[model samples]
Target: MSLLDVHRSIVVIIDLQGKLMDMIYRPNLVISSTIRLMKLADLFEVPVVITEQYPKGLGSTHPQVLSVYEKLTTKKFYMEKDSFGCCEDQFYSILKNARPDTNKQQIIIAGIEAHVCVMQTVIELQENGYEAHVCWECVSGRGEEYRDHALQRMNQKGAIITNHESVGFEWARDKNHPKFKEMSRLFREGQITS
Candidate 1:
């Protein structure tokens, strides 16, 4: 796959909701990485689509992500769904309504339960002909094994497994890009060093 072009990409934040989020392994890392991804999306004018899986039961999205999203003035797409895979009719309609431009075919994914929702979404994204790139640090499952296996499965199924920093740099493309400095700052600060 080619480096992500900011103008040709979209970030999809999936099912990072309440209690389920709390149970995910290293939830803090996931949250911080996802926040950085959101900021990068905002900086590059990349559209973001956030989904909640039955929020009435799982509760709402984690406040940190919600806060960053709320502050963005760019066109945003938010949907609440019961489907584990976000490729449902409703999501398709929202994506369509967003008027997904021809170049905006690359989808960057981040969220919880990598073995399920994230994996399913990535598979479906590929089926729909969109290149899927999963931000490794931004997705987690309740168990390390689950997360690893999910990523392996995704890679086997044609999804590119990558990190947030790689995605940001790929989007920026060069130091000469207007937002490179801020993107670099975000890359440094957003990393979780054990």
Candidate 2:
């Protein structure tokens, strides 16, 4: 219930794997928004943790996403999980520690399957006392109904339902905070996809 602080934020990119990515309702939008979020995270010096659900089956994170991630010099980690909810995964504790500041309690999530993984992760993070900010356009399910309802459900449960642009400006907090130009370019690149 607060404006996101860059020092308190950690970007968690979840389950944008191949087979699964292709199944989402708006995979391109998810990819585009996620890419932007990743860039913002790096530019703002926020840490990031990426999760792939059973890469052996789902394929690794999408190539476009991986490319952005690969170029990030900020604190980062890539973990593969069997658990739908990231908190349930074995690497949960380590992922929490991945950020330079253990005080980074705000979870900025962008990924696929809004109804399952994204929903469970947001709810669980809140239950555990972390402020979860879900990037709306950066997540989606196999069907529009499922995706829409899941987002509504998360909002009802106290998760801050937000978009990628809001996150960047919130993190920057002011026009002179630095990195605004690069952040603006990412936004202008278009978060929407055909």
Candidate 3:
């Protein structure tokens, strides 16, 4: 129920690896939404944490996504892990090091395999007292049904189920905000429909 405060938030794009991304349902939609979300985060100066679940096996985070991050602030925190839930020790360490202020705990989660990695990450993030906002449009599973069930399950478990556009506008708060023009441009390029 509340809008995401950029000062209290961080963007977490998880496990959007190579082959897996191509297999996910609606891969183009998910990737486009995620790219826009990351762009919004960059515009707002929110810390971005990207993870790959065994990249050696799954391949690196999709090249297109990587290219976007590369253009943004060089402050990208990249983590590689075997764990499904990104709430691991290394993740905590990187996050802590990224922001250092304990109060910045709102997590905007976007990525693939909604029913598995995304689901587990949201659950553990909520359990750890972090406000986990799941970007519905930016998440997908191997099947549409699984992604739908995952979103329902995460919502039931207290993660705020939202889309990338909602998150972007909520964080921007007002059109007069300094980054508004840039944010608007990104959304337009994304061709996100109401």
Candidate 4:
């Protein structure tokens, strides 16, 4: 309902695991967009939550995505889970509790298998009273129809159907924020033309 406050937002990158990554439609777009979103998170100093779904079977989060989190000192949380919806994972407590200083409520979502894991997670995040902003380009299914319908369903359920650029601009807010210059620079670099 409001702009994404840097203090109240968290980037949640879900289940971009190895074996499933290539199976998704527009895998490269999903990866690149998600990576750019992560960079925006770092620039804005927003926290990020990265989840790996049954890494033993899904084959772990992709090395490039995982490496971004590893290299950044930006606030982050990591969890490995068997649950399709991250909210169902026993290890995940509360999204707002991710940091002691802020009660984060908007979840910027990115990840794979949009029809299954991503869809379930977005719906549940809504049920739990969090704003689930699905970055369209950062999510994919093995088929385009599945991904599109999943997004449609989630939008119908009141999830904010968004993209990485919208999220970045919303977070940056205005040209006056301390990180606005860097935020613009990130998006300017090889950004996909919408």
The clash numbers for all candidates, in the given order, read: 0, 0, 0, 0
Tens-digit per-residue lDDT, 79-145, candidate 4 = 8888787886442464645656655488899998899989999998888778889999999989999
**TM-score of every candidate relative to the true structure:** 0.94, 0.94, 0.94, 0.93
Worst 10 residues of 2 by lDDT: 95-104
Deviation in Å, model 3, residue 105 alpha carbon: 0.9
* Each prediction's whole-model lDDT (CA): 0.87, 0.86, 0.86, 0.85
Query: How many backbone clashes are present in model 2?
Result: 0
Per-candidate alpha-carbon RMSD to the true structure: 1.5, 1.6, 1.8, 1.9
State the lDDT of candidate 2 residue by residue for 1-194, as single tens digits.
Answer: 99998888889988999998777887888888888888889898888889999999889999999999999998888788888888875556755576535653888988878888999999998888889999989888899999899999999989999988999999998888778888887777743774
Predicted candidate 3, C-alpha RMSD: 1.8
Off by over 4 Å in 4: 89-94, 101-104, 191-194
Error of 4 at 149 (Å): 0.1
- For model 1, which pairs clash? none
Clashing pairs in 3: none
TM-score of 3: 0.94
Candidates 1 and 4 compared by TM-score, better number = 1
Task: Quote the lDDT for 83 in model 2.
Answer: 86
